[model samples]
Target: MPLPDIKPGRLSACQYADNFSDAHPPLTHVQALIEAERCYYCFDAPCINACPTGIDIPSFIRRISEDNLRGAAKAILEANVFGGMCARVCPTEVLCEQACVRNTNEDKPVEIGLLQRHATDAYFGSPGAPMFKRAESTGKRVAVVGAGPAGLSCAHRAAMLGHEVTLFESRTKPGGLNEYGLASYKTVDGFAQKEIEWLLSVGGIEIRYGQSLGQQVVLNGLQAQYDAVFLGIGLGGVNALGLASETAPGVGNAIEFIAGLRQAGDYATVPVGRRVVVIGGGMTAVDAAVQSRKLGAQEVTIVYRRDQPRMPASNYEQEWAQHNGVTIRTWSVLKALDTTLGHVQGATFAEVHDINGRLEMTGKHWELAADNVLKAIGQTLLLADPTATTLALRSGRIAVDDEGRTSWEKVWAGGDCSFGGRDLTVEAVEHGKIAAYSIDRALGFARHDTASKRTRPTPA
Candidate 1:
């Protein structure tokens, strides 16, 4: 009854600064050169294949070694418009760095992610002519829904190919997860918006904030006005514990908590519990638990149903949470919430066993005392909305072809909202890029020959 012990100023200003400061600092000029020289510049770079966007890793690193940060960043942004954000948030340990030829026991990886940040930071710090140049106007218009990474990537690509793009975003600011869902320490100094500004400098694209799909912006209206439509509206439904009536004060979703923390004016003003228990094992779960600790939570535990190796969060992320004093309680699923006076008091977890890839709950259960319990199980596509009835779905998401063509010929979907998506920011950027090129081809605008023109064609 004492308001659940959630209060502001849990930590001093100095503690807040140190806790939320940049998780990975940028490389100095000499350090960038030293690291860049580590790359062998393979003729067939495995890092490029491992990358979702297929960035020219060797070329960029070579440019970095030559002290051409501008050229290096141009090479990166050409492939991925969100190069800076991806450099910070992407799990290089499992992706590019893992594929590095130099990632041997004898020698460490070339620090590709940091070198990338070095190049992008240099370009962003010193403004110059836009890296991207728009092609001749095709006079075709495209509608891009969601201003997150996928939507922004699609809009930027479509615009660069000379198609007018109208991007619709539900939130006040763009960058979707990059701006709202990412951990604060990862992307410090408002870098998300800075990258977006550089991406927009390519021209021929307009962003309409507060315009969400299935609401202010509808597919039927978009289809009628635009030659093609791209939907990157990410998953909107957060999964919950099977236990019903678990809703109570001091209990909430981890994504919501993260968004609040990202937007908070000051970390000291953010409310946190003395004890926090996070549900799930993916990136969001770790982010929630770790950030809770940073917010001065005395104790934080991550409750996951699966074993440690089976956790969706990368090894680096799990180690990060553990290093920050968060206890990883594996093979435990939330059975129920212990509430007092309509507020959460603690949680009950049932031990689970993996029997041939299936989680079987054991008869035994245990309890953990906590005031804040955050749900980070997973996210589901927003199909409950009546507006999405016309869209055919697969595996609980919007179905799309290799080129991002949806069931509707004129409509293309990508990012977390579509099936076959890897749920990685880099992969989402690839989806948008592929969809834009496909849309351009359908519009009869040849990339090589702008003189050719034909009406939008129906899918074969």
Candidate 2:
């Protein structure tokens, strides 16, 4: 393909080491304590309402103020088991932090995400015991597909409720996006695997790796074999740009590229171009652009068809990318890729204007030099055979009710593969938790457990 521009070893060892350090380093003990004091702990806290998992924000902050790290972790985890990972990746500036009452009075919200991270990190660092005890065995078996946030969360909650869980994962490791899709800087120090290991310490959950849906695992067989089946099978396919040159050698999926970077032993081993262009308007695009810069790419540009307000990524994420030297070109659409011998060399883009409320491209077009291109456009759900599965689907994903129950009996689904999924880690965790209780009820198990009182998913 003659792609010489994309090469590894672009930076020195020190530069590589510095580039991948924790994107947001942990708060010091004093910093966390001080941040905890900033909270008013209102009785009707808006922050709690903003949390997708409905975590008790004021109560957790109160626990932190009392110097009870474990207690604080408990309050957070009872609602969201993946609190550690969420604290690292969740869009807090728009969610909980934005909803803080202090934002109204002082224009500064208490650092809830950082405080939660502070407590969760301490507990995970020396998590000797699981917080919740397993109830008497219910003899109910749950087959959870996809070991990403949703499936793993479902598995842990089911196990905690005294049900045996077989977690089916397509890849060798668990923590789907956490392990494979998240930016390296956002989750440094192998935190994804560490969180998963601590979650598995609860017992009664077995993970079957390399077990992909429709390949090694099938829905019909799972329904017959298990008491309840929870499908967290995340979006397996990356959406493609319809342009012809998108197939060039230098072009790639942003998620796949990020996954390779995440799995690589050393940052220097991953190849990056001197000038790279990414196409999309979401967190995946932002991650790809920022990581490309960190990997020593001289120039990185993110081109989105829509303007700033319509971007799926939070305003904080957009600013983060810009801070990392990424050029965000809004109202721009990718026109074509310039290729040399089947290898990408550059891209052409068109500026669009909202005419009659529709984005119609202007006649002028411009080109940017590049050797690498990434498409973070979005993802798609892949069912083994769309016709073979009787489960109802909506908007190209499995349809589910509030409890995550699908139309099919003995089956529930959540995560990005399900309709109404917010594509946020916290929301996915809540989906698993709610579905676990629903599964518990469907199995005719005793409903005297404390988790029955857990809150439902809410708007961010």
Candidate 3:
């Protein structure tokens, strides 16, 4: 067995700088104006229906067209507190843009995502007073665990409704997945932190960093201290490759790699293998593979157990990976790792087939040469002590009702850690928003008569 050839400075300084730049550059004012005019501003827009956060897509675009940048930003942020971040990271091509009416006449839809970024960036660039103000103090306090989209959304909304919010975060900096899990290129220039600061400007919300749920703070303690508790602690456990090389020197979780890349002061200081192999088919896999290539990996491959259509990553993301020179090998299940001297050199996989809707290995085996292997199969929720709380679970996720009320009273959950929703940032924001509304009602805040008017299908 030999040691892996993993080290920093795989790419030159200039290459590293270019490779890690923003994946989607913000549109110039003129470009944004032209794109905004492309929107028809339909009275009954399907794009709004497609948005997970129910952002008034047409209204925002209309404002953009009218050069009402601040108003457009307000429209978007009023619905989704994380509008700017989502505009950069969301798979709008499959969601809002896919449902756009313009897709009927022209194959392409309006650039809703870019338009969104234009509006939000304009507002954030030249910030004014906070868009929304907190209500009079209600003398009620809430504890929000996790600083990801869901928790932040919940905290912001609850605070706006006059509840004091103490947001608990495990890491030194906030923005859980947005800050750590996403590819560095997707959120270039420290946008996640900027968005967090913007959201916090509404006031009445306090963040306690270096505080994790299972460790520094416990569920029981939070319940006793706060009038209500909202858990947005996203999946904290990474799925293993279940192979002997899982802990090999060159083998690591893709999330950790991305987080390191995000936190790296200099991109050239981050180590990347010349040949990298990533397992799984979700956004994490694509992100790791693409970033690996950008980090100067000569050959990068993403191996998925199922076919392309079944991939958790959207078609746009898959295409983006391929465009960036990432090889996509589907119908392959990881079987073993070829290791030497406690380091991963490559991986062995068995070609699989769908038989009666169940994946079965066909006994056909192959290998991909690699100096690094990233496990991006999935993530799991790691509760500090399940017995410490009586919250019910569904398929290992916290089970909550439509409004995010958990089995335990005075407790709510949302985001990836909760049941019944996709792991998209926008979906998590909606969950947090709805959960806050529910919590507000429980705490004697008058419910809007139109609260029942909004509806969205629960994500399975």
Report every candidate's CA lDDT.
Answer: 0.88, 0.89, 0.90
- The model with the greatest lDDT is 3
Better of 2 and 3 by lDDT: 3
Worst 10 residues of 2 by lDDT: 450-459
lDDT tens digits by residue: candidate 1, 257-297: 99999999889888999999999999999999999999999
Candidate 2, superposed: residue stretches over 4 Å from native? 1-3, 386-388, 446-460
Ordered from best to worst TM-score, the candidate numbers read: 3, 2, 1
Question: What would the TM-score be for candidate 2 when compared with the true structure?
Answer: 0.96
Query: lDDT tens string, model 2, 272-331?
Result: 998889999899999999999999999999999998888898899999999999998888
Stretches of candidate 1 above 4 Å error?
105-107, 384-387, 448-460
TM-score computed on alpha carbons, candidate 1: 0.95
TM-score preference between candidates 2 and 3, better one: 3
**TM-score of every model?**
0.95, 0.96, 0.97
lDDT of 3 by residue, 318-410 (tens): 999999999999999988887765678878899999999999989899999889999998999888864456678888899888888888879
